[model samples]
Target: RDCARPQPRREVAAAAGVRAAGVRRAERGELRAVAGFFVEEFFLGRTTDPTDRARCFKSLCADQSRDFSRRYGTSDSAMLIAEDADGELIGCVGVNFGRVPAPDESSADGPFALVANLAVARRGRRRGLAKKLMAAAEAFVREDLEEEEAILLVDQKNVPARRLYERLGYKRRWADPDAKALEVVDGSVVAQPVLNLCMRKNVSGSAGALVENLRWQDVALLAAIVAGVAWRDRLAELADPLSRLLDELVTAIPAP
Candidate 1:
């Protein structure tokens, strides 16, 4: 029992009738699934051109795998995958450290970690797996990487993910201008693209102050639409209520 072999610290606690473990480096097979999940979930939606989508998916998969290896293998990146007792990959979280430099020259400044490609299998949702993976990622950044801050970008439409990140102390930093314009074209909002907001949170700072500075009304509106659709069988039945809720939420928060 006193052998010198290094062991991975169990990053997830048992919950909801399941126990989870962190996937260690050199686990190529699991990484492939992680890559595949991103391709299917996020990238797939953005590409309409079949050829472009195919190329993008290929590039993404290869790049992601390489990225994972470079990060985990070299200790420059931190990734935590949650697996059930039966050895099934249920969820994963990844943080790319030092992706951006801090604006201030403070040694207390942490690496600009980009959280991406997080996914929990369909059947594994609501079991607190996502939180566990995120906690592990945060611990790695805070403790192992000695980072004082972490950052991530979530789709403006991903209300659930946004809520989860917020609960975990992630705030919006800045929204993509292009994404804002696209939303307008898609008939989501009439506001100028330049006014789009990005939320950000300093992991070491007060969560309330961080959230108070950003515009999360859009997210709230989107959440209403999602909830309406989930409850009603048709969009028509939910359209008016959803739209009204969006308007109220957006106007509820003044520009800060």
Candidate 2:
């Protein structure tokens, strides 16, 4: 949706086929695994040159270590991870509750959370880990951090990532006017015309109120009521009591 007028913010899509049960904020012990995943997937996966790869790995390792340390101690920022049933790390993402480092003129001037460094393993691809990670991050932003908006940057050439974000309610509103995309040609570095697209989503609505705020009993009761409607034709006797139970439960829950 880049180069188009702003559209209404969409709800976060439900995750499907994720191997891990859920995503959680990273702990200190998981720092190494998180760093290694980023280096392998984002850095090492990009090049075949041994020297460049080695240097880049070293540099990225230190940078990611410092970044993890910085975000771990802060209450407003977090690095989230998803592990498989075997306890092996499979997906990771980070969110920082603050203003963008350098926002473009066309962007909003208010503070917004930035979602960064989202990565999924090769084996975990096509299994919905990314969506789960994003849902949790946005939940943290709205329910935990109490922020109204979330933004992210993706390379213009990375069509898959861009499409995924769009499906998750983000729109490519603008690009960082001052940012440059660079590539090493034969021997010299040249700047490309494609800028990093800054996509954003508004997360202030009550899209996930029940999932985030309701108790287990409330959810179960609601689910049972919905299911009861399908069987109303066969067993008309149960419909009235189910309706009464739903009414009682709805009255008990406070309005937002």
Candidate 3:
């Protein structure tokens, strides 16, 4: 059956292993997590977004998210987030649709769509949340916005994100001849001039395809939940072990 397109968009897809991924619209309350994420990953590091401080995170999310909602023919243009049952904001992505500049005349002056603000929190790393978010965004662009392709930009230094994009069937849509350096706001960049690459995936005729990605964040969240449930009265007894495991799981991910 075709996935029904409606105002409150949410989708779930099956993956290869035990992990299942779902995609859906961002709730009004999740603004903090979404903003904090951008601050932690982009602003804290190096990003081109005009706002460079955590104090500006909420306003930035609102403005960009508002524009995302207002874009013609793309309700999926709004930000999307992935989370665990504990309501943790596991990952997020944003979609945009408008008249994007075409490199060659052959491409139509399009209401082309782009995906931005893609990330999973550092502690929440290794979960395939990024893949699921992109897939759902592409599906919305194809079916709802009636677009054929979804576009995104990746920093050359962000090799991990680049690899995930490639695995999801995104190809080199365009490459900047003169890419700008990756921006690290509250954070530091060891080098200057990080290269930016554009990637794209075809969304035509692809919807309701289930995908799965194992997430350390998911695992950690679930373990914490289960332990809390089984040992509600023994909270103090489990705290030490849980803390140790959490640290181990998080620090193990090779930094990107």
Candidate 4:
């Protein structure tokens, strides 16, 4: 099932010196603004040429436009934005549903609600805008998309981001420690890849995951359970009297 309607706008309290912000799904009219934010925060630093900036901005807008249509059209993904009281775009995050292929071929792969492109403007820093954006993204995944878990990648060098995600209940997942992703640097793809840490959170409240799709970690856990049971039975055989006493105690209990 898919959720076609985007969430309504939600107001978030700002920091003491910062303006209050509102978060919601980006509209078609705000596509340029959304693209501008990415260029300003991520691309501008790479070059000083206005021509390059323009090209980057156009590329980002086109990419985001496709994303926007996919969300409202197919309900499979969304790009969320946070704007200050003045209606200036300050932060953004994206939630997408897809399969993240395991870096190691031997590992398992499954569908997940992926969180990506989380960014906040310099003016919006220290105002908790990132957290608000994150909250909104997770809400879309959980309430709107009916997903149980979400995953994201954070640069290990970004200590603050990592700390923030950990505080939000995201835990480290099994991933290639040396994995790298292609990154845009200087308005172009750089030869070097960015290192990242894989993190995951259960958005569904305390609900056990269905075993329909199992990861290698799940197999390991099941193996541990089996080994534990085998060891317990072996110990019970070595302690026959204790086992018999426990069996007698169980039999002594009256059936309701």
Candidate with top lDDT is 2
Count of backbone collisions within predicted model 1: 8
- Expressed as tens digits, the lDDT of each residue in 149-194 for candidate 4 is 8988887877988888876778777555566644456666444545
Each candidate structure's TM-score, on Cα atoms with residue i matched to residue i, is 0.53, 0.65, 0.56, 0.63
Ranking by TM-score: 2, 4, 3, 1
| Candidate 1 minimal-lDDT segment of 10 residues | 181-190
What RMSD does model 2 have? 15.1
Candidate 1 per-residue C-alpha lDDT over 73-108 given as tens digits, one digit per residue, 9 for 90 to 100: 455675577767776666777877644333335422
Tell me which residue pairs clash in candidate 1.
171-199, 171-200, 172-199, 172-200, 173-199, 173-200, 174-198, 175-198
Per-residue CA lDDT of model 3 for 127-241, tens digit only, reads 5666677777887777776787777778867788887877676667565546564344453333356456777666675452211222345557789999888787688788899
Could you tell me which residue pairs clash in candidate 2? none
How accurate locally, in lDDT, is each candidate?
A: 0.61, 0.73, 0.62, 0.72
Candidate 2 structure quality by residue, lDDT tens digits, 1-256 = 4695643443111122245446888877777668878777765665777777666667667877787777654778788988776566778898885555456466564566888888987767777888989998898888878887788888878899988887777777676656665443332334666668888887776766324444456668899998888687657777789899999999999999
Q: Which stretches of candidate 4 lie over 4 Å from their true place?
A: 1-19, 45-73, 177-191, 207-256
Better of 3 and 4 by lDDT: 4
Relative to the true structure, candidate 4 reaches a TM of 0.63
